[model samples]
Target: MSQDLPTTSYALLGLLSFGDDLSGYELKQRADRTLRFYWVSPAMSQVYTELARLTKLGLVRAREDTTAPTRSTRRFQITAAGRRDLQRWLSSATVEFPALKHPIALRLLMGHLAGPETSVTLLEDYLGLLAERRAELQAVRDSLIVDPHSPVDRFRYPRMVADWGLDYYESERAMVVELIRRVAATDT
Candidate 1:
């Protein structure tokens, strides 16, 4: 775990989680499937750039294709060195989540500058967004429960947690909609 391993290098480890060697395209697709919820996929250029750096650092090894006659399609595998580096990083690294700075909180803080109508409209808009998001999460929860192969669905406790989240969002959305209706009805 060289502290010098750039942030993008962790993503290469993520690609290896499937326990298969992958061309950069295959790696990118796998990363998209698993990491899209948390991390952005590196652009094709960024993937190549990271591969070059990781190879230079001895964290990943590449093999040239003799028959294909294209260098861009060369495949990579995690080196023994790379696996050791990854395990060391996992054991030694401290996890630090980025700061939480909610845009909605910022808007609420500055909202007095907006007149009552604007404030009400903003709240309504926010409610709409929340409802839409709740629906999306609901779909995710449903799919997880019904899709037998979903990783989360295999564990009973995590499935319960997902159900709880689905209920929580639906409850919150209803409460917010009701509160908005009450506020809009009240006269000064």
Candidate 2:
């Protein structure tokens, strides 16, 4: 591993920004629920491996949770050195978002290479998936009675996440249907 650390290293550092000593599981949940909208997750092995590497580099420190009977249970904390490293990483380079290589985008780009029927089938399948996702999001959102001042809502990052997902999926479903109509008209 390079001394500079990978993208996930900064992700771990960013979680530490919340000012809590967290177990790996807690860290994973936070990343999944909150950071996932704008960040990628490393594999479970990669997370643990990076945590170990961060410990070795004095950027992170792990201590046994004495409150737990099992010594294997540990929580990690960011050191002053870790904070400095994170600051340096942030200042040194611009973060590059990963290029989207979505199946829909690929199908759209090359749909002309396929038969009209094939294109319609692909678009319909994608539309079905989007509709399913939108339904799930709607149900989840409907279940939540929004209380802006609720302490629970304040920390429920995933609710905000679900809201964004609902809007995006709805938009995508509409766009795909319109594109399909255009494709059909053009084929005639």
Query: What C-alpha lDDT values do all the predictions have?
Result: 0.67, 0.76
Question: Please, what are the lDDT tens digits per residue for candidate 1 over residues 109-177?
Answer: 665676456656776887888777667655555554545666643535435755676676678678767
In candidate 1 the C-alpha lDDT for residue 115 amounts to: 49
Off by over 4 Å in 1: 1-3, 65-72, 114-188
TM per model? 0.58, 0.69
**Per-residue alpha-carbon lDDT of candidate 2 for residues 129-163, written as tens digits (9 for 90 to 100):** 88876776566666666577765553356467678
On TM-score, the candidate that comes out on top is 2
Leading candidate by lDDT: 2
